[model samples]
Target: MEKWDVVVVGAGPGGSYAAKTAAELGLKTVFFERGRRPGDKNSSGCGLGQRWWRDFPEIMEALQGLPSVRKVEMVVINLVDENNRLRYRCGTTGSDLCANRWPHGMDGISIYRRDLDPFLADLAVKAGAELRTSTLVSDVIMENGQVKGVRTEKGEPVYAQVVIAADGAMSTMARKSGIRNRWGGGCTLVPQLDFSADPDKMDDVIGNAEWVWFGALYGAYQVNFRDGFHIGAGQWLREDWDEKPTDMVKKVLQFPAFQAMCRAIDAKPREYQAHLLPWLKKPPKTYTGGMMLVGDAAGFPCPLEAEGIWHALTSGKIAAETAAWAISRGDTSERALSEYERRWKASPLGKEHEFGPEFVDLWNSTIFDPKLMARQIQLLLEFSMLHPFSVVFDWGDAHMDCFNQHLEHLLDLAPQFADFGRTYLAPLARGIWPKNVKRILLSVKPRIPVLGKLPDNTFLRLVAKLSKSLAPYLDPAVNQEAPLPREVFERSRKG
Candidate 1:
């Protein structure tokens, strides 16, 4: 048996970081990469978040020399329907589409996995950790319910004081060590298409901003780097996948604007790949006996963005810290390693998941379905991002037509808001709210009209009043009586 202080499985971002941190902490560290090299198994590329720039300065220093690095301060988002009709467009760094209070502004880095992994692995090697590329950890070595280390596919056993499993989302080590069984709903499948674009044309057309297309293919996105761009889409995995990810990627490429953009930039697809990523809606068991799981194996992806590099990096370092502490104390049992979960939860790594449930609702809602999302996006545009611009520009009859349609939609949605009160607010009022007042409010949730909760006659009157207020400024070309309150009531009653 070969013995070491720490054995880090899988040379992904989390595994490399664990090896790096463990070695820096004076532990005998070794990381295993099943691929020929660190980045070989990863999808082509994706964006790395603030944690890479702000939290890990050493990694930043290591990344400085790489050509694959492209730092961005803006992002472009497009919402399109199945008909190839563009529904809405927004940009993070745009001038006042809607006001926000982000202190850091929008900032991130786009890099290929091929570029990121090798350098990150090299950082660990530089910190005096051993690198074992092409080494597959087939199972973990356990003795009397305690993880002793890992066993290679070759059946060579490597013993260590602590084992950190950072393998991909479907981690064999995690299952073999009894941390978690295989997943059905806890992960997503992402299919990627890698393209080499004309660099100059890419800068001209794509620029430095990442482009996200929602509804055209929900969770569909593209990020530009030095010489190429990557397009990908993802959805949660079910036991029997209703939609094939490869088929979805092909359809995404067929989308009118996406295909046109490819033609403009002279893009050529060089690779098509797909992989599983963790998408945990609830907290996961990350530690057991002498083993700690980090990154994908531990389910640390962001709820909204579904990005995991930040979580991986942060959790990997924290897991290593726990390993170091436990090893020094000579207690490598489950009790000692449980601190790994504690430290992560106490850190931003865990707090980032606070809105997991809410976001997961959006992830599965009609908000991601192209046709249904189009209707919702129309509402969002009418009320928010597009409102200010419509105010300044005289878009003529088109604008008035939209105003009328939006009023109708708003009227349609009023009842749904009442349902919201019933589903969400009513139950909560039972606990914290006063009984009499709670009756007025408990009174709420699920799905009822927004104003439908009000005395029936009083509803939609607000919209008519607003229309009357704006009636004077409008030209005769626009119909002021379209959304009249009495007319709306008559329509509803007739139905």
Candidate 2:
């Protein structure tokens, strides 16, 4: 039996980050993982949000050219018939593609979870956290009606004043502790089929492009190309909870529309993996007597686009900070820990969960209606192709600062989303600009379109009417205060 200050379960980005932050903060941290090595059992399409570099610059520096870093700049949305023949298709740039806009015009790289996860874990070790892989936490240890520690499979007792569950979506600790009881219809099953091949053939075409296919019962169809060697389809689904990864890959490969998109780059399935994700929602509760949850266990999914890695890392950091603060105060009570939830919601972390439900409602409605989905995909394609410039951000020296300012602007829009009803232009502007440019665009954008369809006058009229209301927020002082880093912007432009 060993007593530690904080115990993090799971070694994914969320867990590793939590441990690293905790240890660096001088907390006695112990990380328990079920995998043989740090990243042994992991599988992911590995698309990260641009925010990754903002918080964990070290991870980005370490993984700059790793084998799993998948690059994407263009996304093509297509409708595949039952036989996998493509009936309709559209392509657009990473800059203006509103699907999952990046701030700062930054494009995401898909890294192998197998490599990336371990790298983060090793970094945590370097930061002075104890890493214990192959340690399965079988049950949580409680006393005085509060969580005090956990019991591993071999019956070893590891004690901690505060417990953070980064155990991922099917969190056994969460279920055991009564934190999460169920997942909503918003859960997305991302089934991916991975392929490894020659860099030239793969990188030249797949390197710059990613695709989403509509009409599949499982969810959205995605092709992510990584490091010019690994390519996979992250097929999304809101239903068919019973389908296995192998079957999902089989069905997707047979889809006529999916086949057509694959033909352009010559892709084939080499390996298959499955991931079940819960939608963004307020966890039933994040804090208990002496315990809390982070990452997937806490139910913070990437709100609008189902991106989880960034959110997971963000929540993990928040949880670690909360734990550190609580321990320093000699208090791990529910009241002290409540600060974690409050702070998370106060920042973009909270907004991510808030916007998740709306996405769920829209995706659910559209997933079942193939024709409707096709039409929406068509509109997206049309928008991407016709208005590629606005949708893409090619800023030379102003990339990073511009993006940060933009994100700050979007955060400003948070308080107004409820008052303006559906006329919110933030998403439309964001989806169209680089994530870094999104907030800035939102500040100036008057009419925000929802669901990709709006009357031309509808948005302009709303903007005109709201101009006076928005004048105070968009003062010149705000714009001139700071811009993104010029060097990164210039380099990105060159690249």
Q: Give the top-scoring candidate (TM-score).
A: 1
Model 1 spans with C-alpha error above 4 angstroms: 94-105, 367-386, 397-495
- Minimum summed lDDT over a 10-residue window in model 1 is located at 429-438
Q: 43-155, model 2: which lDDT tens digit per residue? A: 64466655666666667766867876666655766665444556556676443454444343555566677778988898889999999999988878878767888889999
C-alpha RMSD of candidate 2: 12.0
Candidate 1 residue-wise lDDT, 334-379, digit = tens: 9988898889977877667755665666566543454556555554
User: Cα miss at 96, model 1 (Å)?
Assistant: 11
- Cα error, residue 259 of model 2, in Å, equals 3.8
Q: After superposition, which runs of candidate 2 have C-alpha atoms over 4 Å from their true positions?
A: 79-88, 94-104, 184-186, 216-218, 223-248, 255-268, 368-495
Worst 10 residues of 2 by lDDT: 426-435
**What is the clash count for each candidate, in the order shown?**
22, 36
